[model samples]
Target chain A: MSSVRLLVGTRKGGFVLTSDGKRQDWKVEGPFFAGWEIYHMKGSPVDPDRIWASQSSGWSGQVLQRSDDGGKTWNVAGNKFLYEGEAGTHQWYDGTPHPWEFKRVWHLEPSLSCADTVYAGVEDAAMFKTTDGGTTWNELPGLRKHGTGKDWQPGAGGMCLHSIVIDPTDEQRMFIAISAAGAFRTDDGGGTWKPINKGLHSKYIPNPTAEVGHCVHHIAMHPSKPKTLFMQKHWDVMRTDDAGENWSKVSGNLPTDFGFVIDVHAHEPETIFVVPIKSDSEHFPMEGQLKVFRSKTGGNEWEPLSRGLPQKDCYVNVLRDAMSVDRMDECGIYFGTTGGQVYASPDGGENWQAIVRDLPAVLSVEVQTLP
Target chain B: MVRVELPAHLCRLAGVGHEVTVAVDASPVTIAAVLEVLEHDYPALEGTIREHETKQRRAWLRFFVCEEDWSHIGMDAVLPPAIVSGKQPLLVIGAIAGG
Candidate 1:
């Protein structure tokens, strides 16, 4: 029987959870790099055994770790992320110009074809890539050097390039989203980029329909339909059919569209999932009841998936990168919570169960289906 | 040879024990010289205690020698006699923080 592995990054550390295709019985492996903040962990698509983790701390800065033998052992990779040219300035929280500085890595996206290549999305909002495994990282400076960079400001979270999606159909095309700066696209393999937020509107910024200052929480794309993308912005759930040329609100019927995570289903391209929180101020589920909403027709219509989930008095929040899916025949869905629970739905979002509870506040979750 | 004690997390990261010894070649044996040798020996600790480019000490880490806080001292200043003579170890500690 085939199996699946879930690489989970938490505030405290990283954990590896493995289970058969049945998705019921599980084996939990870590708290690896224990006591350090693991912001993200991902495995290569071509080589599932190879994994990379972003280990960091306020006192120690950042350390990149790579595992060759699955999650059995790990070695520290290069952590030095220097800008291509002079590091410039961007708008600070008080609207003052502040120098750009390197912070922590927020997300990692392994290459779709090569095991040795990976992309890192980092705070102070920049993009970096490593082609020789994780030994070195070079910044793709065009994204940060855009004309409107100085006008970009931080969201509630710091200014971070938190989401990255590569076009499986076209290797040179890619998409990245930065908090409070809207979404950007690169068609020449990271050499250049342009803001793709044509129809996005954020009431928080001075210009709601400006070229770039929208806080995009997370964006998702299915492999088959790379042009169609789903996004969970700061206050709205949206979708785009022309590969982010434009986006429209598809948040209809959601009790509250304000949430962090959004992901496309494995087998069904039109199906998607979102965990709706009460609002930006209150980062918990509505009525203190945890729920995962599924939209089968891709946005305007949604239904609550509450069976096996906490129905009352549960206030855990799901983070932006905390949700994922495995490419199984039945398509298993997975997500982690701020309350330290990793929930799984083997049969899409109809039912769910916690694989492990009381581990740590999960920052990210990535699943790999092994043959 | 100089004796240096690292914080628990750094020790784990460097795959070393609480205390490790290093030989410094700089005259008068300054803190920067010792750290240069330490990072050279343990590449995993390259950007942890200090910034990779700026070479500035991380804000959350403090340096101590002979019960005195040496965190804010000049990196090139000569080590105290007790520390220079290996009678006492230079301690790298995480500042008291976090909830």
Candidate 2:
């Protein structure tokens, strides 16, 4: 029988949730790395035992942690994240040049083929990779050095590179997204990159459709169909069919397009999920009712999946990196909320149940389907 | 040998007790020399007490020698006789801030 392991990062610490293939009766373990801000935790796809966690604190900067024996034990990996060349400047909120700085890591994406390789997207917006487990980190300078970096301004969340999607078909190609800077794709394995934010319009920015100043909230890609991608921007739900050469709004019938999370089903590439919020000024759900909307045909028409979810008086926000899907036989979907609740839908989005309630405001969630 | 006291969080990170001792062999014992020895003994404490590049004390951390605030003093300043003689322990404390 297969088992599922959930690696959850929270503002207070990290928690590990485990359950057998039945997906019921979970055993929640930890407040591991207690009292530290765990921005993200992820297990390698090739080796389930290998896990990487980003532990950070306002008092003490960043600390990278690695676990080889699952989550039972952890060792502090390298914390040094120096920029490659002379660290240049980016756009400040006042349209002035601001020096690039290293803050806490926002996301960790383990290599699909190698457990020792992992990529880290960090605040102040830069991409770093650790090829040998997590001992050392080297920045792939091309993305930051690429033209228009100076124009990439910070969002409300402090300019962060939060989303990373690796192409399953070609390892050399991958996509990364930054807040207030839009999305970029690297064709030659992080060496060279290009902006892929066409058709994304934001009214808040000076130019509604600028090349690199759009604040993209989050992006999702199904492994089987690398060319097709889904995006949940600050205000609109979008899709790109031609590998991000261009994009068109596919919000369809969603109540309000303002959302933070967007994800694809494990087996079905066209099927997707999103939790719509009220608006940018109001981060809570519409009418204080929590719901998850599913689109069977990509993104035009969405149906609310409210079974077992809070229908009234629920005011929790789902962060950009807080949703994930497990590749179980039945396809399990999971998401964490700012109110410290992690909800799981074992049989897709038809039904929902909370795995753990009253954690310290989850920051990110990643699931591993183990045999 | 000089005695040192670390904050609870840093003690856990360095895998050490609240109070630990480090031997400084330099002729003139400075605060920087003690920290160098302490960091060498526990590599995990490298970027915790001080920034890696600047070697400056973290904003939320304070250094004390027998209740005298040594945090604002220069790192290269010679240590007091009592601290050098192991009579007083160097205190690395987290500032009283945050929730």
**The candidate that achieves the highest lDDT relative to the unseen native structure:** 1
Q: List, in the given order, the native-contact fraction of each candidate.
A: 0.80, 0.43
Please compute DockQ, using alpha carbons, for every candidate against the native two-chain complex: 0.89, 0.70
lDDT to native, each model: 0.94, 0.92
DockQ of 2: 0.70
- lDDT of candidate 1 over A27-54, digit per residue (tens): 9999899989999999998899999999
In model 1, which runs have C-alpha deviations exceeding 4 angstroms? none
| Model 2, span A1-371: residue lDDT tens | 99999999999899999999888889999999888899999998898998999998877779888999899999989988888998899999999999998988999999999988999999989999989888889999999998999999999999999999999999889999999899999989899999999999999998899999988999999998999999999999999998899999999999999999999999999999999999999999999889999999998989999888888899999999899999998999999999999999999999999989999999899999999
TM-score between candidate 1 and the true structure: 0.99
Runs in model 2 with CA error above 4 Å?
none
Candidate 1 chain A: 10-residue stretch with minimal lDDT: A148-157
Error of 2 at A80 (Å): 0.6
- Please report how far candidate 2 places residue B20 from its true position, in Å: 2.0
Residue A115, model 2: Cα distance from true site in angstroms: 1.7
Can you write out model 1's per-residue Cα lDDT over B1-99, one digit (the tens) per residue? 889999999999999999999988789899999999999999999999999998999999989989999888878889987887889999999988888
